[model samples]
Target: LQVGCPGFGYAEDMPSALQNAARTSYARKLVDEATQATIEEWQKQNGKLALHKAVEDDKWKRDATKVGLLIDAERDALTRTDVGFRLPVHLAARGHASVEVVALLLEFYPDGAEEKTWHGYLPVHLAARGQASEEVVALLLECFPEGAKAMCKDGNLPIHLAAMYEASAEVVALLYEACPDAMAKLDAGQAEYVEKKRKQGAAGAQAARESVRALLDKLEARETRDRRIEPETLPQTEEETSETVAEAA
Candidate 1:
């Protein structure tokens, strides 16, 4: 009803840019919906929000229902990263999230698996380093099948990181399956990494290396057995067949 009020400008005086902004509800909605726990606030600080705090406070409780609700409420935080280091996916995979948590995160933000930390560690790398359960690692791998092959800045693959922690034999095996070439370098570099951690008095370092060694030995033996059976499964070459017949005679 107020035509050209003193503070309001005339129609000709309003620029298109200003007109668009004036028509928008930015300020009103922002003020109405303002909260301390906004996704922007959390991401700018440490990539964590109430959901992450709640998960941690609950001590890794695997309440899928509650976590699902949290995700729904804060869907925008799914891909949020720390100021410069880790992403929520990294934290989730590093033994802090249950299989359900991993699955749910991937279902919503599958690309998070490809995100790396400042140290060039993928979520799979963190999962391996944390000695997370096979199920969690499996979920990460399912989302980013090539993550196992990703090498950190230090040239450490997921298997290399897994070898540093005990009870990660299965995770190591899974990474090996994804990138068999990674194993060829395991003996030389992996042992060194484990030894360094052991000297630092890291808990279970020796035991972890032993577990990795056991898995490697099993893999080697299996490879040897398969090689011995390969000739029988393949069609014999002419020279090999003649040699075999002469040997039999």
Candidate 2:
């Protein structure tokens, strides 16, 4: 696994030698003999390829330019999953990577949002878990709205995971907005999973969960109000009222 991987947070202190290996690979096209030699040197130096490091670097730094350069220089790494249970896009979204980096990965692999990790968390799920910016969540939703409703292997919906794991109210709000119906449709496992999170007493957990609950209340109230509005209950103009009276008469 990459040392400064997303979940581990070690990428910030990644080895200088590793960074140099990647820089050497990035300076030339993959097909060049010098590039291959450099790659061989990198392998002997670190036993991993520069492309993977570049992808990981993009995730940690949120640099779309580096990501684009790496992708252009190492297209095969586009779909390659790192040893650390993530694709390049997964790492990007999970690391709260910039929207440009996230968008670039999506453009290259539109289905990445749905690609599940070994733990059954997709990119969107990780984005929520990572407390990613609202824009990142929206970008994932734009590509795969169904991902908003995706369940982890353990049976927790994305919103449930977000409310429980993520502390950002905005991130929770974005997930809630994406799947309002899920809020009302929780089964036993879902409720239990969330209740456990609420009990954790983590900083921002209570507020984030409550914010989702408040939104659900508002949505439910709106739904009830809409359901109660029959044609007869709707406001009538004076002429319509008079017509109704005349018909009754």
Q: Considering summed lDDT, which 10 consecutive residues are worst modelled in model 1?
A: 1-10
> Global CA lDDT of candidate 1, please?
0.58
User: Where does model 2 exceed 4 Å of error?
Assistant: 1-60, 185-249
lDDT string, candidate 2, 30-135, tens digits: 3467645644554455333444454445333365555555565555666777676677788777776776677666654565777888888888888877777666
Model 2 scores what on Cα lDDT?
A: 0.60
Error of 1 at 186 (Å): 1.7
- Clash count per candidate: 0, 2
Query: Quick one: best lDDT, which candidate?
Result: 2
TM-score of every candidate: 0.55, 0.55
Error of model 1, residue 201, in angstroms: 26
Cα-based lDDT for every prediction = 0.58, 0.60
Residue pairs clashing in model 2 are 4-10, 4-11
Error of 1 at 215 (Å): 27
Model 1, 157: alpha-carbon shift in Å? 0.4
C-alpha RMSD in Å of predicted model 1 compared with the true structure: 25.9
